[model samples]
Target: MKMAGKMDEEIDLGLAEELGVEYEPYKMSDDEVIEALRQINKEVPWEIPVSKELLPYLRPTILCEAHHPEIREEALRIVEGAETSIDAAMMIFYYMISRIKYAMEPPKTSPDALRTRKGNCFTKAGLQIALLRSVGIPGRYSFDKTLLKVIKIVVPREIFEKMPGKFTIHQSADAYHIERRKWIQCDTTFDEGLMPFPYNWNGKTDLLLLCPWWRLGHVGKSPYFPVNELLGRFKQRGFTKDFCAREIDPFTEHLRTLSIQELCKHYKRTLGRRDADSFAHILYFHFVGHFRDVHYNPLFRYDTNLEDLSDLQESGLRIFEPKYSVEKFEEWSVSGIPFEVE
Candidate 1:
């Protein structure tokens, strides 16, 4: 089901018997099974004080510094008027997707994200998890594998063709909803203007704007910062700063050529627009950062460009990999029926 310790490959569950793993059948009436599924899908109101089992998600890791004073303060400031945990989470989600600048360079840790307001998907997920944990909400990360071709809609053909990998890691943060007893997945990697999907999170549905385009396949869930493992993998694959520049610099140059209006119009046509006017205002801000700093480019913000922070990424290597004891994922049976584990 898994390949070389990477994302799981979809397989026929009936082959489990062939693989020597015993297959188990469901024992319940159709109505009972339907009721059980409804319970799984039910949206219950968020309640306070999650169980002790969720402690792993509440604690701080090197990448997710929930215990840091700065993280706590910023979290409190962001959710000042929130009455419930769900409200606080929604507030945090909006702040992350709107205020924070998406970049692939350094300052990836939660505390660093608050300091710089910039990071890639993992680091952004780190900030989200840290902020939620700071306010006593259990938070974790879910990983997926997205093909590099998915971003071809945004990136120019020349740049897309030259990019290295076939697939890359995509990540999102999860907030535990106590009443529902489930973690709601929220992908805050793309800012509001950049993403065509409506900017909304109801503390129930998954907010993955890019999933519709990326054709993402599930990897696994982790209570700890899985970026460490990713960093290690990148090192194993010989990914370096210069190599990143090879792929990134060309895209950055291309952005310089296009006007903001052109960029918006291009996005509207390829990715659809969330509003009436092309997202000119948002693209303006994006251009401001892009022009001011050569490191900034909207097209490949999802790609984690390790321009600097080699020390932090190196330090995280192998230190924060997730253990199966605390991981959660949707499971399937031989009959193709799904099951949940907590």
Candidate 2:
């Protein structure tokens, strides 16, 4: 797959040239890119038709490096036994989420996220898109304005306090399902351990409910990775690594005080019944069963030595909180009036 001519200035110039595609190092300004995204959002149909038009979605970009040898090889392994595009897409989505643990301040690119095995919504979406595209499945990044209530639930109060009252950029991914002949949206932000039992995607309908937030609107879709947009919007408003490190202990402590019943209600109201019950179990395991930290799920992180209750208490809870912070947000950024919606 070749990088689209329009995207030449946006992608890695050296890589594009190495692949025998036309190349330019600097083409579009950040402003130009943003305007182009606005146009792309306006022009592209949500139900993207299957055609050569999807070529851009499949091509490698700086952020979504589908052409990377490692990414391509991993994608092949993940979908080795898949019989159809839908199955491959599903396998890729699950594999991406399973590899990357959900966290507040994640890596910006797919390769970094894959290396660290930790990321937030945007990074997860980016990695998933890269993986899908690596296997010849056309994929794109999605952007949206979503409520802070979803974030407030997972993070510590101190971090949440610095955040906007509502409406921050929420990201997800879309993979073109060959059988359905359309793009299927999948929010693989939360991994299996953090998710409920019944949550799934069939590659026909949107799998957006995996997240705890309701979508508000921003750049609804993009043919390429939207990581730069996320950085531009959130960077000035972001907190420092020191701030996140100081807040990690408080966040970890606060997890213990979280009311199971209240969490269940929140999950049920936002995510659905299955998530509610599953989250409750996770909390139950931590608090009552004496698991060290609710966040440390061995399945995703590859942590072999889970300390026993007595050993855990002595060593202290070790939550792998991301050191950086993207928590800064302002209400006025999204709407002139403060967001009052629950």
Scored by CA lDDT, what does every candidate get?
Answer: 0.54, 0.53
lDDT of 2 by residue, 77-183 (tens): 88876767777887776676566667666235566667767667776887898887766677887766666656665576566777755667677888888656788
TM per model?
0.58, 0.59
- Displacement of residue 270 (Cα, Å) in model 2 is 11
* Best model number under TM-score: 2
Prediction RMSDs, each to the true structure: 19.9, 14.9
Candidate 1, 1-342: lDDT as tens digits: 232234212223333322221212223343443343234222223343434466566666546767667887788788876666767787888789877755543224577677767666777898999888777777887777776644554455665676577887777898887656777887787654344212445555665545344646877777765443555444444444344446554564454355333444455555444321323232323323433444322232222233543532343322122221101111221112233433
Off by over 4 Å in 1: 1-50, 153-159, 211-213, 233-261, 268-342
